[model samples]
Target: MLSRKEIVSILLLLTAMICILNAALFCNIMPIATSYEQLAQQTINAGTAYICILYALSTWVYHSNYSEPRRQIRYVLIAMLILLIAANLAGLVTVVKTLFMSDLSEAMDMRDLFSSFGYLCRTVAAVLFVITLLLLIIILIIVTITACNHSWSISSRQDSKEDLP
Candidate 1:
């Protein structure tokens, strides 16, 4: 049961964190002057992006109610819940790859594979994946603010009306 102010403030802070983390992700993953190992490190170290979303969702649930929006909130919550699960699934993939398909992970020698088309394709795929992850962060921030503010503003008006009577 967060006070309305607390909810707004928390959401704002989460939005800021999302923006910063996304910038870091983009900076590290994009085809810059950085080494290939730096890009790999960025991918492997991208845990904070998902964790922030999970915590923000948890905060929303604690503060939100069914009266917030009978239909839209349900749909939105379901979608975010799915995303949280998917993020965990992705993390599991990271762990599995670490244990099984990690031959080149140590050597990172793409000299042989770099000449192959598949390696280039895979690198592009990973870069796009990180871009999508950043997009999700922005989406969550927007959805949270729009939904919460709509309900909060309406409630404020009703409070004023009740006070007048």
Candidate 2:
């Protein structure tokens, strides 16, 4: 039977797949830009969807222990979690800004509001994507350093035991 972590990882992977599919659909439906504003809006939506998919994949990797260096996994996990939280907060900020703004109704019609909101969301998601990428790189470095130390310690212990005998 799979462990709880494995189960969660699988679920996350599934979610990531769904997000990817949705992103593909969004890209497919994107209209040819007649103006700079239209191009920007489409680009933002596409970028946001892609970032969200990447974030989901990162979550899966963290949960699955796919390449986790055993000794440093906990620290890596914690750091990744912190970054994920920040990313989520950025997304939340985008939503709140779009939904609760006093001038939301006056800004544009329904279609315009949606496009504007998507653009803002994309901006936040891009920031989140960068943070998540940084977290992954940092964790990989920590894992490598700790793995080397662990191996060195084991070898030293074996040498000491041989000398005692």
Candidate 3:
């Protein structure tokens, strides 16, 4: 099995890629200030990018063995992951609402290829976001448990050594 650090690195890379793609999709959809939904999507993309970068950097620090075993990095990572998941869900809901509420007759006119492409990209991004969120959650849980068990084992070993005559 891959180490926690490696898993985190991979997840962070994937998260960053997804966030970048989502940002690009939102930028192509419509002008940022044109609608509340569009503006929110842009904001979500930005926040996701920030959190992903932060978590990625933190993972490096955490795995470098320079910090205490109970560092706050894990808590921060969990919080950020939750935030990212929420933002993705919001974006997904907005996209689904737009898709359903949009006028089909106008869409069928085929006059605006960019608009159609934007919607397609948003749909694709939303699906990816869901998959990434699930992966992050699962990885986070596993990493946290592994870290806890590792720390416990180390402490127990030290205690046993101290008790040796």
By lDDT, the best candidate is: 3
TM-score for each candidate, following the candidate numbering: 0.42, 0.39, 0.71
Question: For residues 19-69, could you state the per-residue lDDT of candidate 3 as single tens digits?
Answer: 777777643567656667766766777777777776777666645554454
Worst 10 residues of 3 by lDDT: 105-114
State the lDDT of candidate 2 residue by residue for 15-124, as single tens digits. Answer: 34433443344222334453343344334434434544554455455444343354455454445545544543444354344445536567665346446555554444
Candidate 1 lDDT over residue span 101-153, tens digit each = 66885677534534445354444444544544554555556555666677788
Clashes of each: 0, 0, 0
TM-score of 1: 0.42
What do the candidate models score in CA lDDT, each in turn? 0.49, 0.46, 0.68
Task: Choose the strongest candidate by TM-score.
Answer: 3
Residue 68 lDDT, candidate 1, scale 0-100: 50
Q: Quote the lDDT for 111 in model 1.
A: 43
Ranking by lDDT: 3, 1, 2
The global Cα lDDT (0 to 1) of model 3 is: 0.68
Clashing pairs for model 2 are none
